[model samples]
Target: MSNKEQLYQERLNRYMTAMDCGKPDKVPVCFGIGEWAIKYTDYTFQEVFYDSEKANRIVEDMLPDFDVDIFSGGPTLWWPPMFDVMGSKLYKFPGIGLEEDNTFQYNEEEYMKAEDYDDFIANPTEWLVKNFLPRISAEFAEPGSYRATIALIKSSAAFAMFGAAAGAAAQRWAVEYGMVGQFTGFTKAPFDTLGDALRAMKGILTDLRRRPDKVLAACEAIVPHNIYGGIAGPGADTRFPCFAPLHRGAYPFLNPEQWDKFYWPTLKAVIEGLWAKGKRMFFFAEGNWTPYLEKIAELPEKSIVFDIDTTDAKKAREILGGKFCLQGGIPTTLLTYGTPEKVKEHVKRTIDELAGDGGFILAPGGVLMGDAKKENILAAIEAAREYGVY
Candidate 1:
């Protein structure tokens, strides 16, 4: 292999090894981009979020700027224009709903009323298709509206074409750049699914307090859909694996009792089902997960990576070291505001705590935001080589 090919092979080997529970020569980094990189390249949210070709070019131009390993999908994943035009009451996009520069925020009001819980539990698939779909999308504002039906059909066809084109562009870029891909498929926590679909956060919290039974029931009811919803289903490739982002189940949100009953069971079922399919789950436990470390440790061994959120890494590492690989903990604020020196220091501490024997990868606590300085980003990217050698 040429020197460049050697470097690419080395990077992929390092990343895959760590992800699969073996230590590599040095820690590997996954440069996660979520429109923030496009924004970093001085493009507006509307430009990238709306146009695929422009977005793909921005991504292609920017990859050479970082020393990270994996590419977390491409801009084809964003579809706010559809959401905006569709009149999704659930979310307000950056330019259309909020200020142009602001990030998208969830509009967490209950479209599914408490009285409808039983019906939802009985047949969520039918209920969602019949009752919920028409209510949420702007095109289908009125039930039995033919305009909405036509709008959906046209939108679907248009987006399908864009998706195919965008996917090809991303694959072409991946080969050109020699970048590894993360997660072949994905699914959400059943609780998050339920919270996002039937009960918005505010509505779910209210349900938890007032209707604990229904809260648990509805969350439980979503399990089969969550399991079969992605490649985690039967006869899928275990090699590529699934990336799961979990919210609403961690600390500062629910006590152990509430989480055990309302959150973890169904989520566990999804995890275990995916594991049975030989799929490795790279999970972003997207909140304070300290108290749940032991519970996570109790999961089936060497089949997961916890891309931890804002938690005490020292404690989490002590709890999770042997059973699962760990990723993340570099704060986005540091990348956005802290000095390059500070970025290196923070990442060093993270690697020191998490990169013990093996089973550790480096990444930010979450997706990088618009304000993240390129210099600080560089420092974090280079930290693996500087201080992460085994």
Candidate 2:
């Protein structure tokens, strides 16, 4: 067999083994693209977004230097131009990261005046089709070698929260208004139309306290769009979930009780809805899901994969057991500061501790930053291949 084919087969074997609750030649490792990559590679988000050929070239150049097992789907936030035309707002910091800024002056008052659930429903498809689809279709249609595996689609609940209309309206809008408006609306909306426009986190919390049923209902309505058969579903091979972080703004202010009460129920509903459609969820629970591990553990087996950041891996293994696959826990901070030997030691320890009975994928707790040391990443991958033997 050719060298490339052999390496590919080796990787596939590792992946299949983990999926089947068996041991392979080694533990498979997956790397996520994050802010660190931007800093380390000094590549612009636009370069990664618009030009797949350039992106692939960069990945090929980097692979020899850092032998990661799985390549990332792509930069997580690659919204098209339609988002801007739909009046979607984006929050940009000098260096930290970029996200949809849903704080709109008009939306705050509108939501406050919305006396009942009916006031929140808006059709986003009209906007999406009229405004966004053309640009994305054009971009993807262009011939390029570096096609990504995963495709992220916006959820109706998320769009509604940010002030974009959902359903046929959003899709029709994308088709009609062209790509600019569609991209804008898709990126800038809230989890559900019920949340506050100015303060999306507070809005969700308030809804959880004041109008939970409405939130639940809204979530249900949005799930259809988030699935494979629906307007926004990314196909079977892709693993993408409608991601919503619990806490907004800075950390430390997150209240666990509030999260369980306000977020968990709705999230559960959304996940279950997607589950029924046969899409496995890769939930990126950014904060400590330890407090709610029991609840999370209740999710269907092999259908949900929890990517815990900064959570206790040992406790996670205990709580989750064989119920669901667990990804992540390798700290990014260590990758930057530690030596190659130290990184290998950490990877070995984590694998030895976690990879006993299967249902685990080794990855950084979050994403590898652009500035992360190449040597450290190589060490992590090497450790997995060498020490993670069956």
Candidate 3:
């Protein structure tokens, strides 16, 4: 094999071995070129988010210098041009609605109402198309109007174009950079699918008390779709885990009783369903899940790679250790506020604590923001390689 291909295999093996709760030559390190990377370049947030090629080139330039196994993703998450065509009200992209240098902002509203539960439960896809789309898209509100029709066509075309470009970029990263993608498909916990963009936090919280049954019904109805998405649809690869950014399922959002009743069952169902198909969930638990660790351990072995954001890492390793891979060590805040020496110390300490006997990948606990220092990021990677050896 060529040098890049050999490097790719070695990194992939290290990553997969750790995922299966086994030790390899070294602990796999997962890294992402987040919004922080843009600050180092001449580009603004608007430039990278709107231009896929520029974003891809920036990531490509950084890949060769870093010694890491898995890559979480690039500078920006979405291509704003796709949303611009549809007049999407979901987010105010940089330069479009905000200043050129400002990061995007999510405009969360009650797009799905409590009264709409029955129709949504009856036919989720149709409900999203007929009701949800119009609520979120300014140009598509009138549905049959010329502007709405054109918006739909243009948005769909943009989706296709963006998907193609992204696919090509991923391929280039794999072949040229030898980077293993963190996950293949993307999904959310059923409750998050209901709570995040649909009912909105306030609306969902209110519904839990007044219309509990409707909330339950809607979450149950969302299961099959979540599973399909988790696997990236039919015939998609199960080699990599599916990314599931769990939101409301975290502690305090739903009390133990509420979480047990409303969140765990449906979320567990999705994980079990995906696991049955030989797919794993990258359980991106973003907040403190200390109280829920025991409950999370009930899943079938190797069904998840539990991320430690604000979650107790030691407790997670103690409970879910051999059963699942544990990812995240350096907190994003450290990368932003701490120095390179401090970051290196933190990485070394984290590896010493969490990388024992295998089943750990070092990464930032949460998404790195634009403020995260580039030097600290480099230190974390350097320290991981130094201290992460088995």
Candidate 1: how many backbone clashes?
A: 1
lDDT of 2 at 58: 56
| Best-to-worst TM-score order | 3, 1, 2
Model 1 Cα lDDT, one tens digit per residue, 88-202: 7777776777776676677666779888899999999889877787778878777567878776776677667665775586567556776777666668888898787667888
Off by over 4 Å in 3: 233-235
**Which window of 10 residues has the lowest lDDT sum in candidate 2?**
179-188
Worst 10 residues of 3 by lDDT: 230-239
Model 2 lDDT tens row, 1-390:
656556655665565555444566667677743434544455565555334444444544455445445544333243333333322333222222343221112213332332434433355455334333332333322223122101113323343433332234323322332111101111101243334332245666666667767665654554555443321432343233333333331123346665555456655665675567655566666656677788888777765667767777889889986777777757888888889999999898998888877777788876565557767877888788788766
Which candidate has the top score in lDDT?
3
**Candidate 1 vs 2: which has more TM-score:** 1
Model 1 alpha-carbon miss at residue 376, Å? 0.9
lDDT score at residue 26, model 2, on the 0-100 scale: 63
Per-model TM against the reference: 0.92, 0.67, 0.98
Q: What C-alpha lDDT does candidate 2 achieve relative to the native structure?
A: 0.52
**Top TM-score prediction, candidate number:** 3
